[model samples]
Target: MSDVVPVKLRPEILAQRAYKQGQPAPANSFKLSSNELPFAPLDSVVAAATGATEFNRYPDAAATKLRQALAEHYGLTAEQVLVGAGSVSLLYQAVLAAAGAGDEVMYPWRSFEAYPGMVTVAGASSVQVPLDRDSRVDLDAMLDAITDRTRLIIVCSPNNPTGTYTRQDEFERFLERVPSDLLVIADEAYIEFVTDTEALNATRLLADYPNLVIARTLSKAYGLAGLRVGYLLGNPRVLNAFNTTAIPFLVSAQAQAAALAVMQEADSVRARVNEITMRRDEVRRALIDQGWPIPESQANFVWLPCGELAERVDEILRQGGIVARTFPGDGIRVSIGEEASTSPLLAACARALERYPYLRREEAEAE
Candidate 1:
């Protein structure tokens, strides 16, 4: 028998690195690596999920009812809404719909790791604009990176890892410089957690920018990460493209029901968001008080810019039965979960600081 494999995968697929998600630690450990909502789904959402009777049948291919709910929530029409399995899936779909072989996709480096991978998988070239010193998206640099071949530009505000947001004015300036034909995807996965009124809501910008697309999810702030439900809002033409590329019945009946139910309970969701915001601030202050070099996080997490000290801090936290994300030579990203989660993380931070005083000193000196 021949030992050789029968078929070779696509060149682009072969060249891409496997996407890595935050690690899941032991059950007893405080799982703070993934930026998931600490609270459980509200009673209304749970009831909606259980009350869904269509599990025996295929979900609405277009997710009509769910889209309507989202449109009403965001003051958009159902025609402008496109639902997907998750924002991650919609991201891939949007990139695929915009760019293909020979085209280029540009985004901020270390913003969303998925951006580069999605571009590659869609047979497109990736141009990464490095972040600024503060680890915020360098809008000017990203605009400079754009070329005729550029088909899509992704801006992840309250960016993952860095947790920095691009203000409205900055975003508007960048948008003015970009070509109208190019698709601009604003990934607002952490939008609900943002406390700043000046933060740009891509949805509000959509009416003026025909090529703009905004992807949002119930995963982070709405506590529906496990449900894999997210939606995209954009011009009818752009949304039509997403609809063409989307998988049929991508969102499940239960997920749709829960998402719709959650949207109905806006006040409840806002209350939960308020709690998370307070906790996030408290955690940030606690870390700063301990002399931890943390960044200003508008998301539900804090970023420690300790570079090589990231691994050591992660190990220390792990030993205390807590898990934080370590970006090897970059830094650490710690999620602010429930009070139960934050207590252990705060204690672990104290222990880590005590054990690695020299590392902290080095970080301070380098800064």
Candidate 2:
């Protein structure tokens, strides 16, 4: 045997942390971790997926038909659109296209856990700006972190974990301050759950900002998490870079067809979103009433700044047959799916409070 082991790998890959996906509980257990839509795919979408052909052939490299549908739905042209296996995949591709060795990518810490992993995997440095007291992105800090080596900035509106969004005017101001040469990614994976009229629509900003890219997914509101379809909208040049970095045949034919069908039934999707919003409101109110530290969530999830109580709360919920996402030192994030009943979530919260009275006492003292 050779004295040296035969291994070829970048040091960055070794140092990188793997993405922690939401856990899947046993059948019939309430799964409120991944922020999946509460409803199932429309009949049209189901039929499209089931009847998908061309399994023997490669999927459309361009995803032309789906691109056209998305463009029309978003009032953009086909050239301005690109589809990927999912928003996460598109995020990885965008990071690769924009940043490399010695470059820095800026994003809010605790916003998206995947940001750091993606940046590190691309052989770039990650600059995580801290969020504000309200758990919203600290725009001033983010601006200060920008250096000549900074090549990309990712903004997750209605940010994951926090469920708070940057207001429209604030976003416009930030856009004005950011350098025009740097690529700005607006990841709106939870946009469908947003009910705020004043929220910034990242797609509308694309025309004014050539470097802007909006990454959206069907995994959330469209109830197609399993199908894994997502798209990016941006300038033709930026999109070309994304395409060059993307894996070939990344999006399957069935996913593409299902996404097209989902886009066509916009009304049905909106209705489901309305239902989720109602449940989200109920859950938020119940938590606050129980003296839990709950933030105003615009996403299809609620964030509890319970800190160490997160693990305990997660355990209680799991024991109660509901699985929620816990971020260790951060907190817990519970998805507001259609199947998520207010009674169960409220009961879980109450049980957690009962088990850990100090959590409630601490919040009370802080207030």
Candidate 3:
């Protein structure tokens, strides 16, 4: 591979690498890196996806049926719903629609890894406010960071990797202070796993905030990651702007059918979600018992704040047949996997703590 290119390309794109995904685990290992559901798809969902046989024709560009379903569920008209390949895709559309050169997009740092890249691709500068001491997004800092050039702001509840959620009152206060003309996206991709009654859902405040839009996906809770069915809920005018930026027919026929079928199977979906949330709580408690400074995660994963020892800790987990998402200097995000994985996960954490005694919060803070 040569660095030289025959054609011109955006220098920013040239300097940046494509998004990297979680590493695949060995067949014998428990793969907990990607935060995917371990359960199988419900029979009805599979049947509906398989039943969509029109491979030769393009999917409904509008995703009418899926939009109608989502709109009805939220008590909104169909115009307020915009479906896309995934919530990530919808986010990209939002950024592109609302921002450009000389503009800015803001979000919490150490939140979603995708936020910075999205801003760069939109030719907008990123304004990332650092998280608080507890690794939670500091709403006050985000409000202070906002400027006239800031066109959009994103708030990811149950923030990825950190697993912390913004409280409902805190979020409402932040929204009240934010400029009403600016667009704010509440990325609730992991909201389905949250058990905290007071956590910010964002949907409840939609009618009051015309500038607010909520992005959700069937990926984590509904086990529809492979199909990439996600959507945005907001004012029709705002949603229409995002829709204009979307690549037509990006959501496939199979995804729409699966989404429709799964929406109808709400009882079954809730059961599966409950199972995972329970397991998640158990894992967090066990990690805390082992002296790990695990954050209270409303999402389906736990964060191990390994700091500078992240790479070493990842090696320890790997040796225990656990493949987790590791950020070299930050921390490791271990998904709450099968019950069979619990023992090994705990064992690995114990070993790591033994080998590096300073990793525990009390010891690390003393340093």
Roughly what TM-score does model 3 have, to 2 decimal places?
0.98
lDDT of each: 0.86, 0.87, 0.93
Ranking by TM-score: 3, 2, 1
lDDT of 3 by residue, 124-151 (tens): 9999998898889899999999998999
Which regions of candidate 3 fall more than 4 Å away from where they truly are?
A: none
Top TM-score prediction, candidate number:
3
Better of 2 and 3 by lDDT: 3
Listed per model in order, the count of residue pairs whose N, CA or C atoms clash below 3 Å is: 0, 1, 0
Tell me which residue pairs clash in candidate 2. 38-338
Error of 3 at 45 (Å): 0.8
lDDT string, candidate 1, 23-75, tens digits: 99897898888989878789999999989886679988788998888888778
Report the lDDT of model 2 for residue 334.
88
Model 2 backbone overlap count: 1
What's the true lDDT of residue 307 in model 1?
69
TM-score of each: 0.94, 0.95, 0.98
Give RMSD to native, each candidate. Answer: 2.2, 2.5, 1.0
User: How displaced is residue 283 in candidate 2, in Å?
Assistant: 0.7
